[model samples]
Target: MATLPKPAAISIRTVGPFDLGRLSRLHKSCFEEAWSRSDLAHLLAMPGGFGLIARLYEGGLVAGFDAMRGVGFSLCRVVRDESELLSIGVAPTWRRRGVATSLLQASMERCRAIGAAQMFLEVAVDNHGAQRLYEEHGFERVGVRPDYYHRPNGERVAAYTMRCDLEARCGPSRGP
Candidate 1:
């Protein structure tokens, strides 16, 4: 049997409007088509929008890892009782090190705190790694969107729509 790798040691924190430049740089490093600083600032400024970033530390020094570095980030929006996971990206060298998982977990906690009953996201059909991560986090495939992603080379790809029932996972609330 193959042993699963251990998750990396990191910290997650809420991202604010001031993080636009860092977020943009990280997004560019992770994706072919990246969101600009202006785009990130605008999204984060929205009423229901929020984001989280994962960072690595060692000996009390941040960004200690030469290669792994700062792990990843996640952007989400919650309105009413529903939430959408807009985007998530992990640094290439930091993939499979639990960065995305930590980000997702933190994002879910934030969403639930803000009264989100459910969360949804889309993942490219070919991205099995991301799919597995989402599944591990209780996200289920509810549908598929054909040609949902356009590649830099003009190729189109399909995406799976996944949803997670936060209320079900957390059980019933005992509050007003």
Candidate 2:
């Protein structure tokens, strides 16, 4: 039904604090509730948090744009040796463009680089698409929080907590 944008030139890589504006746009675009600029800045400054962005280039033209604006991001809260995916959104215009996948991959790599042993996140009960994505990435349902997200009508949406063993996925095995 819809066509996706052409891939960017430069492969995906870790995004640092310099890309705050771009990430802010994407965060606002994707969520009814988004992280405020102060919050995002604070997160970046946090010692255990990992933030990144995707830069696309082609033919001397940054073929792609800040997917962060009105899209999704793979984020995590790294604490001690563990991490948690904070949020992710695919720009409404850029859905199915492999952007989310790229973000996830980069986030995971960041976690590993930061010495995180595991990663986890919470998704709305109705978000099957995200659930599937996480599943494909080796995440499994570890727990659930009933009536988690508050709805406009004062109702609550259940939240499913998913988790994956980062080291297990990319590091040496410690199994029988």
- How many residue pairs clash in each candidate at the backbone level? 0, 12
Model 1 Cα lDDT, one tens digit per residue, 97-149? 67888899888878877788899999999999999999998999999999999
**lDDT for each residue of candidate 2 in 1-176, tens digit (9 for 90 to 100):** 76756665425555576667768888888877777777888877777776666554444433245432324565677886778888877667667777777788778767866777788899999999999888988899999999989876787899999988988775742322
Stretches off by above 4 angstroms in model 2 are: 2-10, 58-72, 172-176
Give the top-scoring candidate (lDDT): 1
- Candidate 1 has a TM-score of 0.87
**Model 1 stretches astray by more than 4 angstroms:** 1-8, 60-69, 171-176
lDDT of 1 at 172: 50
